[model samples]
Target: MKVIRFVLAVALLTTLGAIQALEPAPMERFFIEFKPGTGAIIEAGVRADGGQVHHHFKRADALAVSVTSRLAKRLGSDPNIVTMEPDARRYLAAKQALLTSQPLLQSDPFAEQLVPYGVELVQAPLVWDQGFEGEGITVCIIDTGLYEQHEDIDSSFVLGGHSQDPNSQWFEDGDGHGTHVAGTVSAADNDIGVIGVSPGKASLFVVKIFGEDGLWTYASDLVAAAFTCADHGADIISMSLSGSSGPGPERKAFESLYNEEGILSVAAASNGGNRQRVFPASYDSVISVAAVDESKLVADFSNQNKWVELAAPGVGVWSTVPHVSNSWLFTGGNAYQGEPMEYAPDGVVTGQLADGGMCIAAETPGDWSGMAVLCERGEVTFAEKVATVMAGNGSAAVIYNNEPGALLGTLGEEGGWIVAIGIGQQDGQAALDFLGQEATVQSSAPVPGSSYEPWGGTSMATPHVAGVAALLWSANPAWTNVQIREAMDMTAMDLGEPGRDIAYGYGLVQADAALQYLLAKSTE
Candidate 1:
């Protein structure tokens, strides 16, 4: 978008000579810092000059602002202001993560008290037998928010302030990200949904940072939320969001929260499938958590960097979710033909199923958002076909076999990411019967409604570390945050090349081992 605007501005300057100078400068969001007691003074100056103050961190003497580039330059040289940086927007790995969840239409009795693979992988049950289920400990979740009425959460006190609006009640989680992460930290041990590592014993504090879409938030919002966590009685802060850039001030804020407030912070290493250092998690004061599967192997998408501190179960980890309308694909009064093409993301997509002949990159439509595209299988690999649909902003892809019955196939070993479905050759042509009609695609299952769900991401890995930190802290309330972290590092199951390497940080966080580690250290 910025590039497009820049190009337009250049073309205008070339075509129209004198009018170019009258063109308004693009507005940019930034984090502004002023000397102590000067936040009001700096903010006043900004607002008087056609600037908007998004938020004020009175404690840190900082404010997030949006202003023209000209105003920003003027503020930089102002003696009253300390520093300024572009407040970059950090996003949830919504597209990268395999966000698979299905509503069961029927209640299964055997599934009662079902233990999720993640809960078991961290050995939370073993520590439960010792009767130290994160009792009296507090874990703060900084994300969208959680459903207060959720039976599984059972939080004693629900107190949170949205970074978007400091005065607004940040308790409703429109997207299930916060609810799922909260469930992993402290869902009740009741025989309904899956239990959390804390098992209904830990106190929960929250800070809703992400918006309803579960998309992006500025880094400044996250920094402000940390202060809210510390102001409350949170022993640990769990953040499931990540971004590319971390300015000096943001890092300083996290370090101050840990060092000054005695708070332990845990964050996701990101789902980038590469070694790019993502923010919040990559900070020295926060423990960076990576993702592993049920088999305890590192996930393909989990970021691997030297700064990563620990690994936990993140693949297909079952947990709790908020109540939402059924997200199932239906067309022509019947369920859509075909299965979730290998790695389709969980979403509710409703639109026209346009016929795109062979879904080759060259022939793909430029705009396919809010539309399901039907493509013939051939002329390209399934991965390439799906890629074309995704690049064109498609909602879902319906691929039909070139010749034959029902199309039952995979998107190769490395499956595609779009909500892809494989249908028979006849079904593909038949789909045109309702050509212009609306078709839907979603993560659906034939069963009674269920409150539980499963999600995959480094977002899933963060709560594992935070929950274990709470358990270990509760085991010995006398220890400080630093001591608890050191003990965890010492006791974690060593992965990679014998010591702390990139993939699986100190190794998987062990609840029982850390408890024992702290006890042995106390005895010594």
Candidate 2:
């Protein structure tokens, strides 16, 4: 009877889970524009059909509203209205991922200099010695809200900020994307935490367009935010959010910001890897940035196209986030792909990996002396597994998930255990092939402080160019935005298929080189 009841409960839970998964997403919205002098009648038509106006870009004659699909079809035929474009949500191409650390690793990154490799790669330090530390230059970051109180970027945030979502505060960062981008742009030059590429007097004006959890916001919202960037007297606008294509109104806003106000804009080339045309970045007014890694190799995920203008370090790039993340892993003279166990003791352990057959046995056949036990998760408590591995004289434990996801399981309560790391099932299984190989686990709890983490994306790459722009522009405040844009292109370290190829753009953006380009141009 117990068995039958258990089966029934499992089936019921599965059904309930499926029903929850099928819940509806938010309804679709559209961006509509009216022909010249037809706004009054077109708006009336929209209201007549149950459409609710959300954003009205009065200057550009555009209205962002929620309308039924049937109503959208009907509104299209109205002669007074121009083309109606769906208000697509542009997402942050930047994401956080722990890589295998092969081409991305080094011998103790913070040994000599604590600066991120991307900062060094762009040669920001060389320019800083010349007293061009991004002073008098302001960069506007348009994304999710910024975490105002982060230790690195507190004083740098300027003019407060505006949020499209009424509920969220511009200073509140539910998703750390904006905070990470801001840190990369202008974290304080203090000696403690990670410093930015332009770690100086450069100011940041954040415009929050997306809500707390949603990693995306409407193109209309982004358009509206750009104007906010301008209203605050921004010199450089950095856009890390992007969609497949943008509406005519959206394009008009960016063009106006560039052509009229003369604000220099940098954006991430979409991470499609395909040759798809990425909007906003593809716009002639904005400089499109592609992503390369520490090795200067173009990231495979970075979109390859002629629209790409400049390249910057994007893979395994470290900067600030809202939370604490300091634990790391390395294996076999390479950076390993794994995370330290949350409750594991603070220390580093390097040992030869030995298979331990689920690691739950009260006793094991072979001695695990000074070896890291590789065990699959199941049966016993995480503490018991580690205890058993230690009983067998193992130096440490490397637990892997039994299912699909990453095994972030704890050792329950702490004991005198050595370093232990939890990796996903795939990485664990792959680790099985090399049984005798050496793997190092560095584990530490988030006790004191450490708000920085490494992330990957063209989204990460955009801010490097933006920060470099701030550095160059601050050095030469009198230069126009066009001159700043043109100088980077002219001085970029050309890579890939020669001059201005798809992958590397002109090449990896060089800060010192751009300064030289401006100086040489001045002589001419």
Candidate 3:
């Protein structure tokens, strides 16, 4: 028995040894910095440590390299190395659809809604009333590539663009987020789908840092893109992406661009809904923007912190989308509870919800034939709720927000339902309050040719401020970036607490007010 116990202990030790031997070494992509003009020595040291240099940022005196954790520690001890940190991943700061067969629509159906609520919210129309449509100013959109062919997008206004990834198509946008952002910046005023804040005035220089896969980019690629935009003579750089990391070479690149080239950098403060800072928005050199809804309330999804310097309309923002049959109309009031949800009969449905309040599972399996059912968000997947309503013979579904603001959602292809749309919490609650009363709710697709949709995010808000920056810069070409930033902050309509607060930094961005202030300052 003693011999057996000894043998078991030995076997356990052997197993532990094997486990330790088989453990994978930590490996990561790191950004390393060295003293000026030490590229050759740095490269040699990296190679000696079994690291491969991916990029040489000569301007910033840094290298983006891949190495094992053990090798990184060895390199960190080198006296010549200044900073060696792991390369961070960045993401596009917008919610996007995963799948759909809708082709890009060719005509402008919602031309009547041309001037988006965002444009009016920021008072850009008033700036346009003064004839400053961001002319002669170049704003570089460093994000997913711009869709140059959209009817609302003016290809002529696109000075040019470049893609860092050779596999990506720079002129086309497979993900609709970048195109939507571009339209908000400067979609033409051709009386088409919708007019941009600076229509036909500012020329957009697309720097395609993000690829088709929802724009997941690396820090090295982002640093490269910034320099590329600067070399192309971008007067202002607008980026709607962020990372949870701190100041790095990418942040330095933005600072150099802003201080040396006099280019302004504007970025989103993130949608993390937390106090933690995100970069490059958190960087001092970049102007960080938060999001506000149409009611002038700060969006619940918007990140708030001391770094938040500005705010803009981001919720329920209607703008141009990639030409596809993806438009829908949503209307609800105390009436029209029995209307049939209208949409393409090919199983594609456009519909409205009954005014009978939040339709949870308890209300399902009832007499809802030909009538769209309204469901409150939560407790199940949107598909599940719709499926429940369908089981009861409902024709369509409307998922309303459980929080304060509106939401952009998907019903997924698997859900056996006809059509659906999302509404804000306030609107949803109001409809629910009118339960069993006379109420009307409706949703339908626009004509085939015009394509427009609503999206929400700090990503959407950044373009509004960037476009306004272009407008202000065009209006006052003599003003420096510092002056422009100051004008924006000083003139913003203060929200929340008396002065600047975390939620609504300096209040909402007022284009007309900023321009007026700048005009007044110029006269001085």
Point to the candidate with the largest lDDT. Answer: 2
Candidate 1 structure quality by residue, lDDT tens digits, 1-524: 99999999998887787677777668899987778888888888889998999888886778899999899889989898888989977777532222122221222222476677777888888899988899888888998877778878785744544545443346777777888898889888888877888888888888888776677889888887888888888889999989998866788888888899899999999999999999989999999999988778899999999999999988766677775323344677766445455555656678887877788998876788778888888867777788888888887888776664334334654554777776656667777677778898775432322366557899998998999998888887889999999988888888767889899999998888888888998999
Where does model 1 exceed 4 Å of error?
1-25, 94-110, 157-169, 324-450
lDDT for each residue of candidate 3 in 1-524, tens digit (9 for 90 to 100): 99999999999999999999998666688887788888778898778877788889999988988888788878889888888887888888876422121211122235253677788888898888888999999999988887787778878889889987678777767677778888889988886678888976799998887777665777877888888888887888999999889537877888898888899998989988888799888888998899987778898989999999999988766777764543332344332211112221223343444643445567665577766567777766665666677776777666666664334455555424566666555656666554443323344432223256667788999999999999999987888998888899999989998889998888888898998898898889
Off by over 4 Å in 2: 1-28, 101-113, 325-450
Q: Which stretches of candidate 3 lie over 4 Å from their true place?
A: 1-26, 47-50, 96-113, 326-385, 393-450
Q: List the global CA lDDT of all models.
A: 0.78, 0.80, 0.75
Location of the lowest summed lDDT over 10 successive residues in candidate 2: 101-110
Higher-ranked by lDDT: 1 or 2 = 2
lDDT of 2 by residue, 388-467 (tens): 88888998887777765444455655567777777667777877877888866667653323366678899999999999
Tally clashing residue pairs in candidate 2. 0
Between prediction 2 and prediction 3, the one with superior TM-score is 3
Candidate 2 displacement at residue 122 in angstroms: 1.4
How much RMSD separates candidate 3 from the native structure?
Answer: 8.9
Model 3 TM-score on a 0 to 1 scale: 0.76
